[model samples]
Target: MSLKIALFGITRDIVGTSVIELPAPAPATVGELLAEMRRQYPALGELRSCAVAVNNEYANADQPLHTVDEIALIPPVAGG
Candidate 1:
């Protein structure tokens, strides 16, 4: 299966786009997905302080993920 991810802030720069598709199989979790993404895009190293959301709600690292789930990365904010 394929999962669509919406990248934001530093994540967008790391991924070079606002969206990305991830491979599926062997189960997936918010943490696992983020880890995999970090592995795929080392540039995301800046995402150490990032949080994740599933279906518009803050998700825990251990939260299970489905192949068709909507995932988004909410990185640290910096503004006045």
Candidate 2:
């Protein structure tokens, strides 16, 4: 049971990939998952305005997660 997280914007650059998959027995909550990722990729911890989306909807820190859940990292955007 693993969690695959889609990466977008700066997150993709920071993580150096479009997707990141956690090893088996992934974290149970959004916050925990993010925390685990941050610990692995210290650069990700530098992001101050990132959002987590689950199954196409914005997710909170305590949102429950499953191995099949669709997760995405949404970073701030800017336009000229």
Candidate 3:
């Protein structure tokens, strides 16, 4: 399955793009996708924290992913 991921903040910087296409296996989970992403872009793992959103809602590690789902990578944010 092919998943489209929208990148934000430091994630975009690390990936060097606003979006990325990842080839994932069927029945993949958010956690699995994250691990694959970390494998491809080790910099992503350096962040203090990150979140994955599917269809505009935060996804859990066990959340199942679909190819047609709207996915986004939200990096940690800091404000003064």
Residues 1-80, model 3: lDDT tens digits: 88899998899999999999876453389998888888889998999998899999999999999888999998886768
For model 2, the stretches where C-alpha displacement exceeds 4 angstroms are none
Please report how far candidate 1 places residue 27 from its true position, in Å.
5.6
lDDT per model, in order?
0.80, 0.88, 0.88
The CA root-mean-square deviation of candidate 1, after full C-alpha superposition on the true structure, stands at 2.0
Error of 2 at 65 (Å): 0.8
Clash list (residue pairs), candidate 1:
none
Q: Output the lDDT of residue 66, model 1.
A: 78
TM-score of 3: 0.89
Candidate 2, TM-score vs. the true structure? Answer: 0.89
lDDT of 2 by residue, 1-80 (tens): 78999998899998899998888888889999888878887888788777789999999999998887889988876768
If ranked by TM-score, best first, what sequence of candidates would result?
3, 2, 1
The candidate 1 region of ten consecutive residues with least summed lDDT is 20-29
Stretches of candidate 1 off by over 4 Å are none
Candidate 1 per-residue C-alpha lDDT over 19-54 given as tens digits, one digit per residue, 9 for 90 to 100: 887755533888888788778877666654878899
